[model samples]
Target: MSAIRHALTTKRADDFSAWYQEVISAADMAEESGVRGCMVIKPWGYGIWERIQRLMDDRIKAAGVQNCYFPIFIPLKNFEREASHVDGFAKEMAVVTHHRLIADGKGGLIPDPEAKLEEPLVVRPTSETIIGDAMARWIQSWRDLPLLTNQWANVVRWEMRTRMFLRTSEFLWQEGHTAHATREDALEETHRALEMYRACAEDDLALPVIAGEKPENERFPGAVETWSIEAMMQDGKALQAGTSHYLGTNFAHAAGIQYQDKEGGQQFCHTTSWGVSTRLIGGVIMTHGDDDGLRVPPRIAPHQVVIIPMLRETPEDEALLDYCEDLRKLVAAQAALGEPVRVLLDKKPGKAAAKRWDWVRKGAPLIVEVGPRDMAEGNVAVLRRDRLWNQDNGKPAFSFVSREDFSAQAPALLEAIQQALYDEARERRDANVTRGVTSMDQVAAHFADNHARPGWVEVQWSKPTSAALEAATEQLKALKLTIRNVPRDAEPADGTCIFTGAPATERILVARAY
Candidate 1:
């Protein structure tokens, strides 16, 4: 009936990028660290990351992978052993030349020339080279095959351009590496990792993703094949949420990871590396954030339900807070998403309305407020982040319910929110994908305007090789798009290739990505 004023100053429609940055700030998730291409993840942001880590680690360990840590500084010689790996990351690697620092006499410190080591070290961008060396030492026979290991760590890439969580110079992530005895086993593990990412992103994070195989040109530097889970952001751009690379024997050969078989012969192990990073947080913001702020999916929300007592700083405030505390305990006891509900009672000194908006902006799944009147009536006012406003009144869509009833229904409500977010994202993604485009001309025309929010195009392709592939890539580059992936469940191609005009073999998704 009337215009609704949103909590956020920036609206997604007006400018998505600015809106994204605004959400990060208004939600208290993160901010620029004053260093180029780096950010400081605040408590709320790190809390979300911790939840994701706990949930994802459970999934990783369930697959029989063991946790381990590696040195942050990898020897330059280690990367030199893998030419392709070095070539791929050369521009981004942060090299450590000297071991110590000295005063420059100008009140600043500089690397001490005298402390230079015989060999330079590279801050790890990825662990393939270093992990390969460990696998080589740890495995000597078939009994040690399928050595599964993972590490949660930070990596430096020296990015020239960065956003808070999306593409920073440094970011946190979990990298899974495994060595298999045969090519078949390695491929299976790769697919398993991809499926794991798909399930985690969809079920846990409520970000529906398309799991697919990347083309040769998009594969990891030394990988034989690479697969990724791509999620569509609200702005119609694709975010590569996670990737699983079937490295084959490339890294094993580089690190000399050989094992003796029952036949008494030595063979290089086939390897796979897969990872998901903080970038998924960025995906969540773009996928579920509204004009008001972020609408975090319940499964990954640090605090699913937050109770803010409507404190008046009077004697009656005690009773309201006591009632809210009881409600918090009840909600916390209830199970949701196969875990105990995480609910917080905000007893901090603040106005209830102010605190409610604070939690709302932070994307807490549910916010409950109890006043003296509500306490006397044994009721609470609840606001669902996913359904924030009532257009009829241009006000917050608050529901009044008895405390006992709300506590009993908390688990189901959370599960529903998680499913609803996933459904919304999936529907949007499916609708935006333009299918059955037959030619490069059509694809170009469809995304001709740079400012237009053209989602993606599914077209038939011959899966060209070498020079032909390069030419096809240049054509797409001219349109500021790239081949996102070839969906694993796509229909068999029945038309000619859009680029080469040859008989098409598979369907590939083309889109502009983050």
Candidate 2:
């Protein structure tokens, strides 16, 4: 049997929820924080997010957006600027009522009401309100126009129900806020930003997504339109990977972000905001994970290749250790992402088998084992996480390749694993997407029947509205299904709404989401 085959206690097919939690625990990725609804991303997990940050920040900068920091606390009055916008976030906001903590002489510290400020402050649920206020002050003319800025920061929302990386009271993310003098320019910026998100999700994270405009009921509050990239997880659930929004002067109107036009008249700037949070870590975890553990995409994995040296206290063991060290340097010096390839040489004194299993649970894309025998053969044993899940397909836990061949194949292997993960996810999605369904009963049956990994079904709807879909809301909720998106790439189709019987022209994606 493959050494890492039985590492996980649960089968993904038997109990997916428990399997997911187990994978996170076994992988040592993240854990609950002392504060409710917050998470402490361990080094292994944070390392992956750091890779994501580097890749995403580079892409954001290339798109001409500058990074900046914003105050974490906003005055309560700021939220009142855009009533609808603040209304959307009011329930999740964390408010600061007192300025100091004092001993109440009961052996516990209490909030000092006497030190309260004139107005309460809100911990940033989102930066749109405060950023909009800043834009109002920064803009004076059309030349000072498009204030394109992004901030990599932590935000707090009082989430009642929370998960580690998916939904937390506090999480790390990048929120982009941009202002444009013209509506056309603002919309273009919005689209470009969303494309960046799609590029990052698909190209780097190896998660395939359907890019589309959200239904009105699902659009971000105060956004004229919200564009999103939604990816299907292995368990047949949709994960909203990222989003972009066009504000259409709504925030500008509220915050007084105006600029003098070429004709010397003042006009409100059209605005846009978009963000992707740490929730993406969860998306990646679910998208490519299997019964064994996380099959983290190489582009985002902290360590692309981890080399384990199978050593012993023998005269020849020194040579094997030397070979492993040399191989590490050789692999680390090679460039794949324009940065040094992250390589780890596991030299801890322990059982080689256990060490091998350790990296397997960690989901390092490639694991190489070098031993005295391997040194004599001029080759190394390679264990790929992407391939470890395929033991049932008659594949070995690890394969043997010449040292030279392995070094040469290092970059290609990473790319191959990356592409394979994406292709597999896409295949799962395509296989389950039901077609030519024209009735609410059919839709419900499709969702209910996929067993454990029920996936998405693309249905053509004439009237793609919440009201139209809500006709079967009770039945659909019983099935735990909802419309994922009105795909921007959806081609014109001839059909009617399954429930409303309205003439349909576009396809809507339906699935249960995370």
Number of the top-ranking candidate, with TM-score as the measure? 1
Per-residue lDDT, model 1, residue 380, is: 92
**Residue-wise lDDT of candidate 1 within 61-146, one digit each (tens)?**
99999999999999998878877887889999999899899999999999999999899999999999999989999999999988
Native-referenced Cα lDDT, model 1 = 0.93
**Where does candidate 2 stray beyond 4 Å?**
1-4, 313-318, 389-396, 464-475
Q: Spell out the clash pairs found in candidate 2.
A: 37-169, 462-503, 462-504
Q: Tell me which residue pairs clash in candidate 1.
A: none
Local distance difference test scores for all models: 0.93, 0.86
Model 2 C-alpha lDDT versus the unseen true structure:
0.86
RMSD list, candidates in order: 1.1, 2.1
Q: Model 1, stretches more than 4 Å misplaced?
A: 449-452
